[model samples]
Target: MKSGYNVAVVGATGNAGMVTLRILSEREFPLRDIVAIASTRTLGRVVSCGNRALKTQKISDINWSDIDLAFFCAGEGVSSKNAEIVADRGCIVIDKSSYFRQHPKVPLIIPEINLDTLEKGASYGIVSTPNCVVTPLVMTLKALSEVASLKRVVVSTYQSVSGAGRRAIDELYNQSKEIMTTRSSRPEVFSKQIAFNILPQVGNFYESGISEEEEKITCETRKILMADVKIAVTCVRVPVFIGHSMSVACEFSKALPTKNIRNIFEKIEGVIVIDRRGEESGYVATPIDVQGEDAVFVSRIRKDTSVKNGLLYWIACDNLRKGAALNSVQIAESMIKIDPSLSKFRKTYSRTKEA
Candidate 1:
C-alpha cells in the first residue's frame, strides 16, 4: 500500500461536506493532504481538519488529477456539473447527491448492504450514496431479508430539517423563536411552518402524488436490496435537527418470532436494537438521542397484526453522519479493504503523473 492518499472534499462549507471532513479525521483515514472545496462564493473560507485550518478552494480551480479521491457533498447541481470531470481526470468520486444515483453506470451504494456493487463501480470511478432515508431502511431490511423472505415494506419517515440543508436548520431555529415571541413565522425553507408542526411533504410532489423523497426511498431501497418487494413510503419534515427516524412495517414470506428478529438485528455490525416494548427500560431511541451516533438504532419491534407474517419497528440515525458523510467515508474504506491493491495503484498513478 502507498503511504497515504491526497483527498478533496467538494462543498466543504456545507453540512454534509463538513461532516465528511470531520469523519475523515476521526477515522484517521490514510491521507497525505486534504483539500476543502466549495463554490466560488465560499472560496478562501476556512474549514477545520483536526487541529488545522484548511482554506476552501472553489471547485473550478481544483486540479482533479492531483487528488486521489474526491467526496462530492454538494447538491445535485454541483455534482451533475462536476462529477464526471473529476472522475475522468482519474480521481475516484463518491457522490452524495441524487444526481447520478439512478444512473445504471453509477452504483447506488450502502456499504453495509452492497459493497460488491461498489467494487464493480470502481472500474468506472464513480459511486453514489443513497438517499439518507434509504441508508437505515435498507440496512434494517437487508438483515431481515436474510432470515425471512421480504414480501413488502411500508415506511413513514420523520426526517429532520437538517436534511434540507443549513438554510432549513436556520429556518427551523428562527421560526421556533418567532412563534414563541410573536405567534407567527414565515415558511420559506419548508412548504409549511416547521416549528411546533409537521409537514407531510418532504420534497416536491410528483404526478403520482408521492413526494420526491418518498419515491427515492422506494426506488433506492429496491436497488440496494435487489428485491422485488412491494414498498410504500410517506416522508415528513419534522422539527428535529440532526437525525432521521422511520416507522417501518414489513411482511415476510413466513412468520418470524420477535426474538429471532431482534437477534438478527443485534448481530449486524452497524445496527443497534433498543426494543423494550413492555417495560420501563427507557430503551427507545429518538432522533435527539441518535444525533452524531453512527449506528442505525432500531426500537419498538413488534408483530403487525394487520398482516400475517408481518413485523413493525422504528429506526433513528444521524442523517448527516451515517446517512451522508460517514457512509461515503465507509464506501472509500470498503474500497481499500476489498482491494488493497487500490492504494498501490493510486500511488503508482500519482508518481506517473508527477513524472
Candidate 2:
C-alpha cells in the first residue's frame, strides 16, 4: 500500500460529496489528481477544495481506468450503473450508497470495525459505508460486545435533515421562516411539516411499514458489528441541518457492570466517552458540536431497569462526515496503504485554471 494516491469523488456537488473533498483536504490525502465527477447537468460546476475551485467533470464520459480510487457519493441510481464500471477498470471504489451494501461480495465497512475484511483483494470491489445511524450505533455496540455478549439492540434515531441532502435542509429552513411570518407551511421535501415537528420516517416505507433507512440500520449493524445480535430500530428525521443522535438500549447475554462498559468505550479509536453528572455534566454530543468533526460521541450511560443485562446510552456524530464521507475516504486510505501497486498514484492533488 502507498502513502499517497490519485482519487476520484463522484457527485462532487452534493453535500456529502463536498464534505468528502473537505475531509480529504483536511487529512491531506496523497493525490496526483482529484477527478471531481458529477452528472451531465452539474458538469462544469465548481466545488471548493482548499482555496481552489475544482471543476466537476461529468462522470458518464470519463475514463475510469485513469483514476486509482473512485469515491462514489452519488445517488443509488448512479452507483448501481457505474460503480462496477469503475471497479472493472481495476480501480477500487469506496461507495457511500446502499447499492452494493447487501451484495455478498461487496464488503460493507466501518473502518473501525472491519478494516481486516479489506486486507484480501479479490476483485476490484466496492466497499460500502454504513447508514449514518448504523455507524455510531455499531461503534457504541462494539465496546459492549466485548464486555457482555450483545444479544439484542433497540435504537431510535434523531437524524438531521442533511441526511436527506441539501434540498431537505433548504426545505426545513424555508418552511420555518414561512411559518414564522405566515403562520403556515406545507410538506414538500419531507412527508410532513419538518419545520416544527419530527417526521417518523426517513425514507419510503416498505410493505412491512419499516423504512428502507431503518431496515438498513438494522441489517447493516448486524452485518458490520454483531452478526447474531437482534436489532430493532426506529428512525426519525429532525429539523437539524447536520449530525445524527441515537438513543439505544441493549440486552446482553450476561449481566455486566455499567462502569466496566464505559471504560471499554474510552479506549476505542474515534469514540469520545463523555459520562459525567448533573445538567451540563453528562456526555452531551450535539450535532452542531460534531458538525465537520470526525468522531462519535457517547454519553448518558445508565442501566436499563426494564430488561436484564440491559444498558442505555446516547450517541451523536456529524452524519455527512463521520458516517459517510470520512468513513469512505478512510477506507480508500486504508486500501492504498495495503496495496503496494497503488502506491505510485499518491501525491497532492492540485487544480489549475484551464487555458
Most lDDT-accurate candidate: 1
Candidate 1 per-residue lDDT over residues 156-218, each given as its tens digit: 999999999988999999999999999999899888899999999998999989999988888
> Ten consecutive residues with minimal summed lDDT in candidate 1?
343-352
Clashing pairs for predicted structure model 2, backbone only: 1-337, 1-339, 1-340, 4-346, 5-345, 5-346, 31-347
The C-alpha stretches of model 1 lying farther than 4 A from their native spots are 341-355
Alpha-carbon shift of residue 312 in model 2 (angstroms): 0.3
Report the lDDT tens digits of candidate 2 across residue range 186-245: 888899999989989999999999999988988888788737678888999988999999
Per-model lDDT: 0.87, 0.82
Cα deviation in Å at residue 121, candidate 1? 6.7
